[model samples]
Target: MILISLIFMNVFAITVSLLIIVADKVMSNYGSCKIIINDDKEFEVNGGTSLLRVLFERKYFIPSACGGKGTCGYCKLKVTDGGGPALPTEKLILSPREMSSGMRMACQLKVKNDLKIEIPSEYLEIQEYIGEISVSESVTSDINRIRIRLTDPKTIKYKPGQYVQIKVVTDEGTDFRAYSMASNPNRTDEIELNVKRIPDGIGSTYIHSLKVGDPIEFSGPYGDFYLQKTHRKIVCVAGGVGLAPLKSIVQYWKDNERHRRIELYYGARTIKDLYDHEFFEELARENENFLYIPGLSDPDEKWTGETGFIHQILERKMTEGENSEAYLCGPPIMIDAVMGVLDKGSISDDRIWFDKF
Candidate 1:
């Protein structure tokens, strides 16, 4: 009698599991769908996938640092029609104004039906490229500079200060991380990036482990952080690896606009943390208009150039912020502190652009 009871219970459990499987298949199926981009191009894709993945499969490379997890706000796009209300995860990243403007996180928005989407015209130009690692060397104890030579497309056109998203494949799955280009944009055939090792970070660890001839896939030239065409003086502030984009910007200026006045204030914890110091110092020596200031928040007895945070260094040296364009990149707290200094020095908010990562 006990054996019969156990058999009955097993049958019941199997029946319930089968029912759940059938229900999931029915509910998850959404059939075919269409995506219209800016009323210009259209794509036919299978429904039920997140818009970010679907667009990427179609070669519309969207900047998603969180790998379709809806954590990074980089995948925001305007869905004019057929997109349902914003999801809660999207609300955490997007502002009220963006929500009202019909902006939605591509990673959170599922393509249930036909959708109309709008993105920047520049996004259309962003394409995926395959490259081979040409140079992989350590910049500091934790930072590495990796240079890749484009193999497939062979060349790329991007402004200095823009970034690229590299695809990292691990045992678990694949992920994407954005890195600002450290090399000058004019070097179209090859691109360089500065990656600081983050403890247990998937992207950084993969990058640090790369060999000289390893292959890589990335898409790019994204972001609007490039240098603008103006006669105003340029003020750059960097902390840690945030100097990547600024290095690109300053190199571009040195090669093209030598007459423009540019000042770079770099902050680190110690002298060893200040990598690429000699390059900026050489630029300053070559160009009278370029000034290099390295500051250390915590220094040893031998340190002498500047002591204190980068904001403190800027506050003491920035005499004419008026008619100057400020470019800042660093941690959130550092960017905020430096912006406050730039504000007090007469720099308008409109002229101060920052990228905090």
Candidate 2:
């Protein structure tokens, strides 16, 4: 009698579990959904996934640095209709003006109903490319400079200072991470990127593991941080791996002979971390119009260059000019500190463009 009772109870528990699973599958399924893009293009996607994933799967790449995590605030899209109230996660990143203008983070918004959204016309031109690692070398203790040769499209055109998103797949799932193109934009058949390894970072770890001949996938030419077309003197400040895009800009200037006065200020913690220091130094010596100032915050005994934060050197050496524009890339705190110095020098907010990673 006791054995029979135990068997009955176990059967009851298993039956209830099976029913719950069936119900969940039936309830969570939302058949199909329509996503109208820019009111010009439309796609039929399976509902219940984040807008970011749906768009990417359809080849409408949206720039997202933090995968679909809603932390990077890079995947904002204007949702015209059927996008429910903004999620609390989005509120953390969207500005009051952006929210009022219907800007929503694609990563946080789920597509349950038919949706109408707007994508920039330029975004429609972005394409995914398959490439293979041609060169991979360490630039610093934690940073690597990787070069990829495009195979499928065979070419790409991007502006200096723009970034690309590498698709990373792991047991956790698939996601994309953004890295600024360090190669000169003129190199259409290939590109270079500098990646700094983060502890347990899915994208960086995958990139670090890549070797020559390893195939990779990425989408590109995103971000408005590229150099502007103006006659103004160029002032660039970079910290550590932030040098990637700045290096691209400098190379473009050299290749195109856009001979406006340019000053580059780079900062790092130690001499070892100051990758490409010699390259910039050589360029500075050869080009009378180009100036390179590399500063070390925590220098080793062998250091003999600028000893201090880059901002301090800028304060001393930066000459205030009415027709000057500033470009900065670094940690948020470093960017904030440099912008303060630029403000004191009478550089207006419009004249200063920064990418804080």
Could you tally the backbone clashes for each prediction? Answer: 0, 0
What alpha-carbon RMSD in Å does predicted model 2 have with respect to the real structure?
2.3
What are the per-residue Cα lDDT tens digits for candidate 1 across 1-357? 999999999999999999999998888788999999999999898788999999898899988876777777889999999988888898899899999999999989988899999978889899999999999999899999999999999998999899999999899988899999989887899999999999999999999999999999999979889899999999999999999999999989988878889999999999999999998889888889999999999999999799999999999988698889999998999999998898899999999888888
Give the number of the best model, judged by lDDT: 1
lDDT of 2 by residue, 1-357 (tens): 999999999999999999999998887687799999877889787788899989988888988999888789999999999997888999999999999899999999988889999999889889999999999999999999999999989999999899999989788877789999999998899999999999998999999999999999999889999999888889999998999999999999888746799999999998889999889989999999898999999988887778889889788889765789999999998999999899999999999988998
Error of 2 at 201 (Å): 1.2
Task: Give each model's whole-structure lDDT.
Answer: 0.92, 0.91
Candidate with best TM-score? 1
Reference-based TM-score of each model: 0.96, 0.94
> What value does the lDDT take at residue 115 in candidate 1?
97
TM-score for predicted model 2 compared with the true structure: 0.94
Q: Against the correct fold, how does model 1 do in TM-score?
A: 0.96
